[model samples]
Target: MHSAIAPIPIDLIPSWLDVLAVWATVGAALVAAVTGVLIWLQILQTKRSVDATEQTLTLAREEQEQNRELIANARKSRIDAELPKILVWIHTQTRKAHDLGVRSASGAPRPLTELPAGKIWSLPDDGASELFISLTVAVSNDGPRRARVTLATSNNSFLLSENEQVISVGEETLIEVRRKYTIEDWAAMSSEVGTRSIQDVLTLTYVHQGTEGAIERWVVRQSGSPLVPVPGRQNCWQLGPFAARRGPLTSLTAEVEMPHRDYYSSMSDLTVLV
Candidate 1:
């Protein structure tokens, strides 16, 4: 019976070899596909790690910037706290006399450009006219310690005359003088003062040392009455007292002005002298 085994078929041998070749190709392709998939997954994981690290670094930088800003603010606050606070203020700008004036050195007429057109004012022999006034002011120290008042400047535009520009806050009333009708005219103008209010504008600049440093203020004037005691003589009113103040200097216009009238008139004196 062993000798009866049939011999292999020569034609079927090629078919078996072809099947083996096909299985070998399939196994190699599967290995390649698995390797490629694993490599792609590794690349994705590396990208995620890099992205996370970058985001963390960015957040850290932002936090660091915030901390730096906070530190700067704290430092500025400390500096501000360490600074000493001192201040000076204007107390009162009281009127002393109303008759102050100015004129050219020569007794002639000078056309003022500061005033309106066709306004020709005469210069008195004493350089006095109805363009100025006499004033006194009060000032105060607004600081914990003592401060010094040093310099003062005038802000005279139209009626440019001042006697005492430098004034103090503590000791006495600072008195200044200049152009216009005398305070004696107050009696004559009392009636007019009751009905209408008039004024003259003046500015005073003061330099002082304190926590807030040097400051400036306007000294203004308002009066209702002026008398033409002399025929056609003009009188400018003095400013109200406003120099005395309690605390620091306030931000205000303080626009007090004297009413101006026609200085040059052709009318004759009609009122009988009392």
Candidate 2:
């Protein structure tokens, strides 16, 4: 009865399998931690890439707009410079045709570029209708002489409007001219005046002389009808009356009277005639 049980065999204990289980658990935890870190790094990189791309696009658009504006301004300058030269040439040709007694059905549109710098023009809406031209003249004279300018316009296509006290010859000396016209009805006015319409008038007082001299005012408009000389208020600028028509082709000649230059202009002084 006192017989002792045989001691369990140490070699039969499960040591290797338990050790393998512990090693596997530690390896799996290490792998999971590494995977989480890699995922966070990837998300941060993706956000930075997106932000950089947006910034690049914004800069490109701004550059494009600036280029477009520069191109527009250059084109406008070319147009302004060439317009006056062409107007003057057209006027000369029109006069030649008239003296030779050549009749035209629809008179040619005078080249706007040939217009003198001292003159200003009001053109109609170029896209929809024919062009309309107007002129302003400034003359400085001492004794008394005559000068002539020819104006060619499409019959019934041109208008004479007023620019008030705009031409300045010198200090305390200015020329003011007003356009005389009757609006048949203000209610009948168009809301939009195009290049074909007399939409606006520009007034400028160009300095033609200094403070001292005898300067006489002259009329600046074209008329087919003979000019009737009338007494005027002292030193007041005079303009011929205009008869407007709706349709017809006609050319006008202006006979200007200017006195001989008694006041010599010095090179140091600035003279802006155009």
Candidate 3:
């Protein structure tokens, strides 16, 4: 009986409820598709935001490094500006004749004329006679700072200034060096004239006053070419062009311990001069 009741609706049209159910199903599918698209767009937008943030952070880091480098360079420039600049050159040289156990000649000191910059001179030299050479060196400050300067020579025979000299900017001072050599010493120096040139090194140590009253130490080394024997002059020699170089400052103990006889003896000589 139950089965016969159901067979009577075979040819009937669809009801409003059935049609409404079908339309509702189609609408649900459309909403789901729109929601899926919106979700994908949101994910893409989130990814772009993350990438933009990374780029900004990377740029910021690069800028920070650049700023650090700039600051370091500025600091170095300031320090370099405050350093002392010193120049040294041989101003004049004079030769005086001396007899054994006798006073030097009363006449004015004879100036040794320099030949061409690189050429040797021709002068007469008395054999077996004592000689006195007086050298006047000019020291100048070319920088904006003032410094206390001390000088020493590589040769132990040359006497230099005793105390530290305060040199002001653009100011020049003269330092006198006097050396007495016997005939034996002169002969020894002359023997090497052709084989090798005799050279002397001059070292200048300075104390620099920097910004904020900071103290710094520096050194400059000056050397001249080997002494060339003057033709027709016995025991007479002349120096060539001079050159200077800058180096790091060293401690007093280290300087004293160096192999240079002049440097080691300079400390004792300074005391004697004082």
Candidate 4:
């Protein structure tokens, strides 16, 4: 029926101030929700930035390592290019020139006569009385190219006399160096040549190919000590472990060139008067 409805209850109807308060509360909640979402987004951006920085550092380290390796390889290559290719080794001289032979009764070279006491080989009474001593240095060409060797620093060692002035060498070449001796050099040396690993050393200037000036230095070791002079032969000394072991006759006297008698002898064996 169209009867008039009783007026709506006023208490149930909210006042304007209450309605404004409700609106304000809703707005505050929305603001708080938006602020929380923004905070979450910022956290994600920060994490991404940290990961990017770490990646960059990793790349830099890898690049640095690669550069170091490249630099080391470059340096090694440079050295290989600049340095000359030469190798050297030394040992006793055992080889002899068979052509210059003076066979004795036993078909072997005779032993050098021990000089008489107080008699010098230098001021020999006869030309035949004069003697020769040598160092017998060995040389080899241990390079890819041909080389020529010239004596550079020979100290004129009384024991190591210099005779050969210059020598030539080819690739993979080897040679026994021979030298002559003079008694004038005897003054610098002791009567007894001492025992040592190497008797002495000689320095050589190696010229590569046609180059006149020296390009590199070459060092050679002297043969074993106590060179026993070959007899009947002017004054050639025998060098080698075996020759040195069978050295110095007890019956022979010491000479001016070689002052050591290594072994003792009797008075009757003394031939020439001093």
Candidate 5:
């Protein structure tokens, strides 16, 4: 037979032991509350640390962008300091006329000098006068650096002396262009004189240094009125004066003429020949 368990009487239990058990339970609850508070504080600290890191990163990015801009501005300043400024103009003193195999009444080719004053040679078939005017165009460099210049024109009417030349600072070089005009062309231009003008655009490509394939280009537009009948002279006409200016190639059609300042103030020794 199994023996039955005997139960102790409640009054026989110790009073101090019950009190100690209650106090132990209260201590465990207090420890749990403190642990939860510590965990919450740790979470708050971690969030603050993350926010600080993000702010640091953002500031660093802004600083980097500022530095990049500063470097770019410095580089642009350096390039501008070394760039060359070129000026172009017509050398009015070098203008001369030439004959183009047109015979006069004597059945011989007439020279320009023998032609009657104030009269140009006319084409035999159309009675249209032919004006062969040769003039020198000056390309002057007023900047501090030297430049290698190449001149080109799409117009078939112009004949350039040479395509390329190296120009030094404070020096000038000449490019001769032969201009031919027929009487019909001149008459049309004469009608518009003082009201409008004709212009021809020439491309000027240049390079400051000898870097391969590094080139800068500009457009030179030369404008003038056509030949007008010389006053008080029968059958006589005079070639009108022309002016040249440099401008950006992109604005070729809308280019405004820069002021006509004397570019030869420091370049007195350079002689221009027709």
Candidate 6:
């Protein structure tokens, strides 16, 4: 009877800590997921920013290259614009040289002056009996710092002029002087001349020089004679007083050594005196 009565009520204790631990575990899982998502988003944003910056830099570099090209082209245009004016000045000077030659030849007290006015000679369109003259007269700048000319000949050797006087960077000038050609008498020789015919190897030598210097001898030859000759000397027989075996012939060959240059202009209607 006593044992049965003792089966009294036994109380069970509740664990509050266990419930709190379960809630904490769920919260931690939520926090971890949010953190991982935020990291991924940050990486994507950083990549986008870098790509944008690079594209902007590339475009800016291209713009700079274009600007440099434009500047270079502008400079070239300016130089071209100035060239014509310079040429006009040179012609003015050439006129002055011609006037001087005439004054000196007239036996008048040479005008104590250098002025633009003179006769410039060119060959006749039909040709000459004794001279080969220039039809294509070229004036040119031999170097950026120098100028020169070439008298384009018909039957004579090339005529080139050296840069005699200094033509400054921006300065334009003309060179003028009289060139004289004298032919020695060829008729006085006896018919008993040497074995070679007088019609062979006859020629002369002339000179070219700077504005103020001694002239240098250049060779000349006639058109009808043998085109080739001894190198150093001008053969007078090349000048011709020839009796053609078959056909009638007129002009002879002549040449003048001229300088070579870069850019040039031409003047026409030059008159040549026999």
Report the Cα lDDT for candidate 2. Answer: 0.32
Q: Which pairs clash in the backbone of model 5?
A: 118-236
lDDT by residue (tens digit), candidate 5, 1-274: 9998899988988799888999999999999999999999999999999999999999999999888777755644554566667776654322345445344788864444333345442333434656554445678888878877887764334544467888889998876655566755654555554434445545667743422122356554434433555566554555543222332221111232442211111123422111
lDDT of 4: 0.41
In candidate 6, how many Å is residue 85 off? 13
**Candidate achieving the largest lDDT:** 5
Best-to-worst ranking by TM-score: 5, 3, 1, 4, 6, 2
Model 1 spans > 4 angstroms off: 1-17, 85-274
Deviation from native of the Cα of residue 112 in model 3, angstroms: 12
Stretches off by above 4 angstroms in model 6 are 1-16, 80-274
Cα lDDT tens digits, model 6, 1-274, are: 5655555344443367777888899989989989889988988898888888888888888887777557645543443343322121112111111112323566653432322222122223212222222211213232344322222222223323332334445554433222212122221121123432223111121122222111112222223231122235443222222223223333322222332212111112211111
Question: Residue 133 in model 1: shift from native, Å?
Answer: 17
Q: Per-residue CA lDDT of candidate 3, range 196-233, in tens?
A: 22334345566433222222333222222224465576
Worst 10 residues of 6 by lDDT: 89-98
Q: Each model's TM-score, in the order given?
A: 0.33, 0.26, 0.40, 0.30, 0.47, 0.28
Alpha carbon lDDT of each predicted model: 0.40, 0.32, 0.50, 0.41, 0.55, 0.32
- TM-score, predicted candidate 6 vs. hidden true structure: 0.28
**RMSD, candidate 6, Å:** 20.9
- Relative to the true structure, candidate 4 reaches a TM of 0.30
lDDT of 2 by residue, 240-273 (tens): 2322222222323333333222222232453211
lDDT by residue for model 4 over 1-274, one digit each (tens)?
6999899899989999999999999999999999999999999999999999999999999999889778756644543343335444433333222212234678764333333322323223232321233333345543344444555434333222243333333444333333333332222122344443233345555433221111455555443332334445553433222222113322111111211111111224422211
lDDT of 3 at 192: 41
Worst 10 residues of 3 by lDDT: 248-257
- Name the runs in model 4 displaced over 4 angstroms: 1-79, 82-84, 91-130, 133-149, 153-170, 182-201, 207-215, 221-274
Estimate the overall C-alpha local distance difference test score of candidate 6: 0.32
Off by over 4 Å in 2: 1-16, 83-274
